[model samples]
Every structure is written in structure tokens, then in C-alpha cells.
Target: MSKKDKNSSNSRRDFMKTSATALAGFYIVPRHVLGGPGFIAPSDKLRVASVGVGGMGGGDVRGIYGTGKVDMIALCDVDDSRAKQSVEAHPKAKYYKDFRVMLENEENNIDAVSVSTPDHMHAVIAMMAMKMGKHVYVQKPMAHDIYEARMLTEAASKYKVVTQMGNQGSSGDGVRKMVEWYDAGLIGEATKVYSWTNRPVWPQGIPWPEKGQTPPKDLDWDLWLGTAPYKDYVENLVPFNWRGWWDYGTGALGDMACHIMEPPFRVLGLGYPKSAECSVGSVYVGEFQQGYFPESCPPSSHITLRFDRPGKEDLEFHWMDGGIQPTRPEELEANEQMGDGGNGVIIEGTKGKMMCSTYGINPQLLPTSKTKDINVPETLYRVPKGDQGHYANWVEACIGGYGSKEFDLLSSPFSVAGPLTESVLMGNLAIRSYDYRAPRKENQNQFDYPGRGIKLLWDGENMKITNFEPANQFVKRQYQGDYSL
Candidate 1:
């Protein structure tokens, strides 16, 4: 076996040992001796804390509450006004305005934490939680930048904590069924994928707003900035509209790519992409077009990503925003219409085609005949039934439920990160590059960045561009303070 393979195997074994001892209610020594970071043992009812308890965080809390195996012990958010209703809902739970203070004060009380902050704050909060021996469920896109994603993945391994990315779609019945069908060869070699979303209900591309409005009393503007460079709080940027901006949000792609692309990324084992480039239409270029663009960044954008699959030929994945969808495939039957609203994914295989949406839940398979075929696989992969439930699957596994057969942290690899993040970042780069110029309908060989559209090679281990320097630089971001991932 290769040295890397040997190291990975060693890490898994160490994680299992540390996890087993913790589940048995033993101190298990410092995990440093076990070649992995230590974790706290499973305690009664699993005391839980929540960071960023608004927006998606509230939904996450509801899901965890659905499990009935956790107690809502604490809640944290920079915006007190947004969290006020949640705090009232969970009258028994303590509340805090900063995550750092919540983590330190509630260390012994919190067995796990649900991190539902914006993309930028995810890595920092999650890393701190795992270091404190708390199980973590971080919302998707996973990290603001590539470096942070790699760091979180590494920390999950090192800390031997039960970790779940809050892409809830990952736990759905249809998503697992899609993976099973692909594994059973329902469709031969998926070479191309098309995923799109109609997002940014908030304004886009508008120039930055003038400094006029006073900050809300319930909001702590400075704490909300966290690790990101400071900017004055504006009504356009806060509450729930940050996704359209450059600094705090990742636009439409970051908002929905994790849900739309989850199936294809999981089934094909498509790891990091080789390179990505983007082009967009002009309606969104103007500074004040329909007042959509936040005074901070572009209003609407489109991007196309070209990825090179190792040991296989190159693949092209296209993404569109502002209600754009792929040209209907000729092979699709008349009944197979791409539905309206939200996000969906269309995968074109050598043999046939498949499309799934609503985050792959209750998906519809096409060729109509394929749906009625009896020879097709019947047994779909399902998460095992348990007292802890689906949201707690990773946590239960950490407590040594099934020995070596338990869910391995590495089972779901970082394949989703490279392509998904690339697509999202491409939108940001395009808005910055072309200033949201007239949308380029035709695919071009050369993007403004030399070799931007060219097929490049990726070394996942080293997280480097074997061929393209510009693309490599795109993967790494400048850290603002002590935050280095």
C-alpha cells in the first residue's frame, strides 16, 4: 500500500479506538496518545447548543428537535433581534450574542453544536467547537474558501468527532436511491451535468449604499463581522441578504449548489475539478439595474465550470442563475419537463439520462419505460433506524454503535467542495472580471484569464494545481487575522 493510504488507515483506526472509549464513558486518556484528537463521551440526552440561531439555524434546530434525543441547552447569534423569537420558543435554553463566549461558558454542558452561520463564519466556529470535544453539524458549502474546507475535513478526522454537513439532502431517501441506481449501472458513465438555481430574491449588482441608516439596536454589528474585514452595516447587507455580496456571501451558487449538486457529486465520485471559468449577460451589468445588486457587489451572474476527471476524459458542468435552465435535452420524453422554481440537476450519461430536483427528494426518473422496468434495482440505501435519528447519524456512529462498520468520516469525501465551490467562486470572479457584461451564449476556448477554459490537473492531497498557477491561486484565499486554515 502507498504511504498516504497507510496513513489514512492508521487515522481511521485511531479514530475508532478514541471514539469507542468515549462512548463507553471512559476518559480514554488524552487522544494525543491515540494518534487522534480526543472527544468527550456520549452523555445522557446529548446536551446541544446552537450557533447562529436564525435563518437556516432555526430550521436546523427544528430538525434536531425532531430527533428527540437532544436538549436545546444554549443559543448564540450576533443579531439578537433575529434570535429573539427562537430564544422565546426555547425558554429553557440560555442565550448569548457571541459564539466564543457561549463555547467557553457552556463547555461542559454542550455535547454537540449546530453551526448555521453564513459561509464565512462556518469554518472558524466549527473548528473551535470540534477542538472543545463537541460534535458538530455545519451547514453546507461547508466553508467560505477551499483552505477552510480542507481544514474542517482534517479537523473532523483529527478530532474523531461526529460531523455532518447540514446539506440535509444528504439524508434523504431519493438521494440514496439515486446513488444506488448509479452504482447498479442504471446509467453508464455520467460525463456531463447541468445544475441551476433561481435565487437572489434580494437585490444584486447595485453599487454600495450611502451611509445613512442607523444600525438596529438588537444587532451587534462588530460581532457579526467576525473574521471578515470590517465594513459598515447596511440594511442591504444584513438579516438574510448577505448571499449576494462578495465578502460575507457566495451568491446563488453557494446558496443552493450543495443541494442541487449533491446527487451527481456523490454518485460519480467526481472529486475536485480541474478548472472553472464564467460568462454572463448584460442586463445585470449596470450599477443600479432594478436595484438588485447590493451596493456591495454584482446583481446577477452566470458561470460554466470545466472539470477534468482523473483517469477519465474532461467534463463540462454548466450553472445559471436568474431563472435560466439548460436547453431541454432531445432525449427527454415529452412528459419529462424541467419543473419551475428553486434548483434542479440534469445528468447526461452515455446510455441514457436522469434528472432530480427538490434537492433530490421524491425525484422523477425518466425514459418512462425505465421507471416501470422490473429488472431495475429495488433495494435503496437507507439510513439505519435508531433512537438518535437521521440528524444524529454521525453522532451515534462516533459513540461506537457498529464497530468497524460504522459511518466513517471519510466516506463522504471532499468531492462536493471543489466543483461546487468552483462554480460559486466562478460567479464571483465573473462579476468582478466582466462587471456582469452581456451574457456570453457561446462557450469560448480562451477566457480572459489565459488557460481559464483549458483542462487542468488537480492533486487533491497537496491541494495544488499541477498545471495552472492562476487556478491554484484561486483555491487559496488571504486570511484576515489569526484565522489561518
Candidate 2:
């Protein structure tokens, strides 16, 4: 797909007219420029750059490079050694220790950039790319905080740049089919959703390790810290464990919720919850605590969120973590195993139920009886055959054409906003209130916002918390000195 093919005739005409008006001397042509017989190729092959070259970033680089249609022109990472694979993968590409410098030096060479950086840096970097007229694909949770998410969304619309959030599950055919199933009343008006994860394999909550150990020779600690407030470079926080800390990441919810909670949030049109609060087990409060947080950042945790349905009265949704599955339905045989690990979502309706894993790609109906029966309603949309590769979907969108209404960020506000905010931030809230005493062993199942924590009325359109001033302030963080929001 190329820009010529991506925009329809009307869109191309509008773009050309806009471009011509913006640049007085440039002549705009609506005709597709040809590079081969009967072929109008991309204006030029997309020259791509990647930031944050370790872990998820490394995987993203591989995916984009595999397409063979893009030129992996630049790779950037604070840790030189961690960027080795990317450097090897695209031997001809330039390497940079800072993304800001890379953008400054190669502003005109790149067509798009993939941001696999931590949650905090997502908005800043993506905004820079969009301002430069380059398309952007950033990893999930979209932004570090609610304010940044709103800013990124607005910027994308303002610049009219092709944008994709790295909730790759959004591209799955199974997700779309599931939405169709809900629309056709298979699950019968999905009033409640439960999604959970078991993550943070890295050490967290444990006392910070001694700081005397030397930093890796290839690591630039200062650049890696970027806009985050200064703190000693502890060995425990680096390489991968930052997800558990509030200063750097949003814990397990931020790490996995975007993918797992996507299906229900989208299909059910679950807008913002009226109020959300967190409850946890065995964590103690501390003197330095500024908000509700888990006492010790436990390896395993659980959180539940409640919402008032638009016209449906009170509707509740619960999330459990630490490999804890919800009470198995009694209809199943006593010996049946509960859902576990990676991630899963359970939607319980007034009638029967439907459950699936993160991508919903290979979902299974409840009760083994349903699986064996041939009378199940035919799935509304046929699940697209074969792997509809995540990166391919984004790249295709970037090049123009082959778009999906169901998966587009703009098209699925409920899918993107509800889960993105609740999953990640709810964990943060739980961690903040970690010291709060739980009244029972199953606090997550019975946690109440109005009874204990500050109750907030969310105004999604204005991105404001209407009820509590303190809670509104909490939505946006104070930038470190010399760093701007």
C-alpha cells in the first residue's frame, strides 16, 4: 500500500488542495506518480527509526523490519549494548544514544517512528514525531498519565497523522468477531467484564539493593532517566523491573491491561466508570505515602473497578491478579481448572457467558458442553484467516489503505479509553493505598469507592475529574524541574 492508494480520490483531492494552500510555491498534483508499469509505488519507501531498543522495542524493530517494505534507517537507545540486535539487524542504519538527538539530526530522513519506550516517555516522543509530519506507533497505555493520553489523542487529530497505539490485539480478527457477537446479542448486552494478569517477574517492593555496584559500561544512566526525577541508579530498577514503581511505570495493569481488557471495553461500549477505587491484601501504609498504594509492591496483586452504567443502573466489574481466577462457575464439573496466566477476560451476562484470552483470537465458550454442541449461533463476523500480523496492520495504515474501522484508535474510544485508564491507573491507585487495612480476605470482590476512598465523577469529554480537586490534580503529575508536561 502506498499513499496514492491509501487515500481515496476525494481524500487525495482534499489533501492536495490543503497542501497547495499551505505552500504558496508548490504545485500539487492529484495524479498517482508511477515508478513501474501500471504501478504507483509509495512516494518513497518509508524510512523508519526506533527508540528504546530493548525488550518490547526489540520485538517491534524485528516486526517492522520483517515487512521488507520499510528501511530501518535509525536505532536509538540509552544502553548501547542493548541496541546490539537492532544494530545487527539493520547494519546500515545509524545508531543514537538519545532519541532527541536522533530526531534533530535526521528529521528529514525518517517517514515514521516506533516508540517502544516506557510509559512516561510515550507522549513526549510521539508528539515530537507527529509535529515533524511523521506517523507514529507507540506502545500501549498510550501515555504515562491521563493528561498525556489526552494530549496525544488531540495532537494526532490536529496533525492528521496516521497513528496507532501498540495494543496489537486491536488488530486481531477475533476481537472484531467478538464485538460482532456482542452486537448480535450472543453474550446478551455485556454488562460486566473481568480481566487480570500476573506480571512483574522482576524484583519490586523489596528494599532497593545497594547502590555501590557499578553501572553497565554501555549504559548511559542519565539519558535513561530522561525526564523522570533524579534518583540513585539502583540495580533492581534497571533492565526490566521499573514496571512496579510509580515513578517510572504503572505496574502490571499498565503492562498488560491494554491488551487484555480491550475486547470487552470495545464491544460493550464501556465508557468511563462513574467511580473507581482499589483494595489489596496485607500491604502496610508508610509515612512517605502521598496517595492510596499497596504497602509492599507484592509480586502478585488484585484490583476491582465499579461503574454506573449509562442507563442500566449499577454495573460492577472485577479484576483479579497474581494468577487468581474468579470463582469458577458451578455449572462446570468440580474437577475443571480455572483460567490462569498470561492474561484472560471473563464476560458474565444475565444469560450464558463468554470468555477468552487477551487477543480473543482463539476464544472458548463456557461449559465444555457449549464447545461440543453444533447449535451455537454462528459468529457474526468470520474471523479473518491466518495471522493478521500486528505490525503489518500498523504499517499498512501508515502507508495508506487497508484500514479497519473496528481497530482504529479514533473509531473505538470506549475500547481504548475505558480499559487503558482503569487497568493501569487502578493498579497505581491500589499501590498508593497499599497501607489501607482490608476489612476482609476478599477485599477486591467487595471494594467500594464511595464508602472509603475519594469518589470521583469523570467528565471524559473535558478530561476532568469533577468531584474532587485533589483527585483532579492527581490525574496529571508534576513534571520534574526543567522537564515540561
Best by lDDT: 1
**Model 2 misplacement above 4 A:** 1-43, 207-213, 283-300, 340-342, 372-388, 401-423, 430-456, 466-468
Q: lDDT for every model? A: 0.63, 0.61
Q: Candidate 1: what lDDT?
A: 0.63
lDDT for predicted candidate 2 compared with the true structure: 0.61
Clashes of each: 14, 13
User: RMSD in Å for candidate 2, one decimal?
Assistant: 8.9
Task: Please identify model 1 stretches exceeding 4 Å from their true place.
Answer: 1-43, 284-302, 333-336, 339-342, 378-380, 384-390, 398-406, 409-460, 464-474, 479-485
What value does the lDDT take at residue 246 in candidate 2? 65
